[model samples]
Structures are given as C-alpha cells and as structure tokens.
Target: MSTQTPPPVATGAGLAPLVELRGIEVVYDAAILGVADISLTVAPGEIVALLGANGAGKSTTLKATSGLLVADRALVSRGSVLFRGEDITGVAPNLLATRGIVHVLEGRHVFGHLTVEENLRTGTFLRRLGRRETERDLDEIYGYFPRLRTKRKTPAGLTSGGEQQMLAIGRALLTRPELVLLDEPSMGLAPIIVEEIFEIIAGLNRTKGTTFLVAEQNIAVSLRHAHRGYVLDGGKVVLTATAADLRERDDLHEIYLGLASV
Candidate 1:
C-alpha cells in the first residue's frame, strides 16, 4: 500500500451524500494496481453506474466500497470510503453489511441447496427485525420480485438466470441497506431480461430512496438506467457525465464500441 494520505471531503451541498470515496487506491498485489485516484459520491435516491471495459477495475470499485473481497491481498492503499460522513476506510465486510452497505456480487452466488425463501432469509442476518418485520420485508421483496413468491420452496439454483439475479437483489433488499453495490446484473442474461433488471434498479431508487452504485460493462443499456455514469479505464476514472450527456457524445459511444473515436 502506498503511504500517501487521502484527500479531504468535498463540500456537502445540503444533505449528506449517501457514500463518498476520496482518492482511493486499491492495489491487488504489490505490483498489480486496481482502482486509483477515484473520488466520487452518490446521493440518496440516485442510481449511478461505474462504466468500464474488462479489467478496468469496475468490480474492484464495488468490492472496496462494499467492504467485501479481500483488501488484505489488495490494499486500499490510499483514500477513504465514507458512509454518512463517517470514515469507513478498511471496515470489516460484516460490519459494513450490518451498517447497510450490502453488495450483490458479480456472480449471483445464490445458495444452491437452499430454497428461495431460505436464501432471502439469509439477507436478514444483519438486521434486527422481529419475525413480523422480517415477514414484512419478505413481502416487500416479493413485491419487487413476484416470481420469487411462486418459487419460494424451490432451490435457487433451479431458477432461471434472470430470476436468480432478481433473487440476489431481492435478498439484498431484505437487509434494508442504505447503499447497495450491484455488479453486472446483466451478465449472461438475455437483452430483454437485462432491460427488466435495469427497470427494477431504477424503480427501487425512484420509489424507495435507495442509493445504488452499479458496476456494469453494458454502457448503452446502463446509461439508460443510470442518472449519472463514470467511465473507468486502466483503474482510473477517465470520464464522468450525466447519462444524457454521455449519450450525446458520439466519441464516447465509439470508445465504448472499441471503434475509432471520431
């Protein structure tokens, strides 16, 4: 890890930003660099996307903020991850989870042997709600994913790709997280299903005031769903703009498609 200190927090406009990262550097090995010099913020009720190509450090960004994936093997060598103005630098994964920083990982690691209902129940591990409240949360999750209700007794692995992704997200919702980090919800799914997943993500942020930081490679599709986007390249933020602005940039689309940025 580098010995450099992190940058100071930017001014909060009115209310506190849901999450903030300042000058954070994640080094995978002593030599393998991950994210570098990233300073970004997510406000309450916003859906933001970390857009990037393969190996551009998108997943690493989510993992660092969510406090999952070993930072020990990698070091958050620089910067601070703040949640509600509190420095969450190097906080434990379980602690972050309990504090409502839930991560729906890159792979929808659904419990293979567990029933769909059981899988959902696992999300409530960090929560202190009573049985009644837990049931209420379950109902809310089911409302978000009505399909899960039908397959509540079935093994999660037996579900369709889209359904399993929904289940992963639904289960995370059960935690009542203040911030959610979703990695590649569209992975390996049909285009139509990807659209459906993005709709749900937008709906949750719009209706429930949930804050989201999604990492996705599907730039055009994700831009439609996100309010703002940051493009990552070589472990650094190369561009940032509102979704509309990015859509307007012909050069941006060209770079995204690996064509000449005319």
Candidate 2:
C-alpha cells in the first residue's frame, strides 16, 4: 500500500460537508482488520466515488458510514462518522435511514419473491406515508425507472440483473435520502445496462440534488459520473483527486493493481 498521504481534493468547498469520516478503522470479529485510518468526506449535492478493487475496503468504508457493519459482526473500532457535523458513528442502520442516509448494498438485493411494486412499497414503510402519498411517491419512482413500471407486477427475482439493480436504487430513493451510499451498482451488468444505470444516477444528481457516495471497482464508469473520488488499497486510502484528475493519471491502473505507489 502507498504510504504517501493523498492530497486534499476540494468538493463543494464552500458548503458544509454532508458526510464526514475521520480516521475510520473497522474490525470484524474483534481481531481482523477491515479498513484502517480511512478518512474522506462527501459534500452536499456531489457525487463522490470510492474506487478500489475487490477486498480493497471500499465496501467496508461504506458499511462503516451507513452503520451496517454491526449486522456483519464488524464495527468502527476507531475514528468517527459524522452527518451534518453530528457524530453518528455506530448508530443503527434503520435510524440512519430515517435521518436521510440510505445504503443500496451490492448484489442487487431485492425481495426475490415479492412483486416489483410490492418490494418498492417497503421503502415507504419507514416514512409512514399515507396511501395517497405512497401512490404519488411510487409514481415518481416509476418515472425514474420506467423499466420497473413495466415490471411492476413481476416478481423481483424474475427480472434481469440490470433491472434488479435499478429496483434496488429506486427503493433506496423512495426513502427520500440526502446521501446515498451505493455499492458496486454496475456489478454483473452488461456495458449498455451499466451506462444506462449511471446515466440515471447522474440525472438524479442533477435534477433532484441528491448526493451520492458510490463504491465501485468500475473506475471508468464511476469517474465518468462522479465529481470527485478516493482510491483505496489494502484497506487504506491511497489517493484522492477530482474525477478529471484521476482520469488523467497514467499510474491509476498500476495503483489499482498494487504495482505502483501514488
């Protein structure tokens, strides 16, 4: 892993950060280290990518932020996670969701047996929306994911991989989140589907002003849509740069492959 400190990358510099992780260290089962001293920030209305290969701690970082670590028998053993300057480290995931932080975990998890629309309705449960309000929100979600509209009555497990990914995101959005922690959204999808998914994500960021912290191994797509990024390696942040700067780095491939230092 690179020992050099990543240069500070400005994101929404004039505004307060929406999410901040300070020297975060994660451990599993008390002894195994997941990630170490990882610090990063996502400013309001910005799309930030957490880029790294599998096992590079991208997911660990996201889990730590969303407080999903406890479910996996992991914990942020050091450092703090803050939201709008409030210390929320180790808070329960459900409480985090109510506070406008929603995580769409990797693997396109959905209620396999539930109808697509049924699965989507679960997102509104946390908000306790009235019937009419629920229908209106569902309509809005369907507008963003027209494919889901077409498959509203179809079982989620029967949908294509790309569709499942879309459903997962749509469900998270129904929570009306301010910061979305998206993990490996492009995984197992075709190139065209991946592009479509990213396009929608970008559109949401543009139109709805929803901030995103995306964890991805697909550097090309992630950087194409994100404003800034932090690259991780061996459970540590190795580089931080604007998306354009990272795209121009000749050694980015080497850095990802552990063949070069930042």
Q: Residue by residue across 1-262, what tens digits does model 2's lDDT show?
A: 2132233233466698999999999999999999988999899989999988788899999999899999999999999999999999999999999999999999989999999999999999999999999999999999989999999999999999999999999999999999999999999999889888988888888788889999998888888788899999999999998988998887877888898867
Q: What is the lDDT of residue 34 in candidate 1?
A: 84
Cα lDDT tens digits for candidate 1, 133-245:
88988998898889999999999999999999999999888888989999999999998888878778877776777888899988767777777778777677778877777
* Model 2 / residue 81 / CA error / Å: 0.4
Clash pairs, model 2 backbone: none
Tell me the lDDT of model 1 at 209.
72
| Cα displacement (Å) at residue 150, model 1 | 1.1
- Model 2 scores a TM of 0.95
Location of the lowest summed lDDT over 10 successive residues in candidate 2 = 1-10
Q: How well does each candidate superpose onto the true structure, as a TM-score?
A: 0.89, 0.95
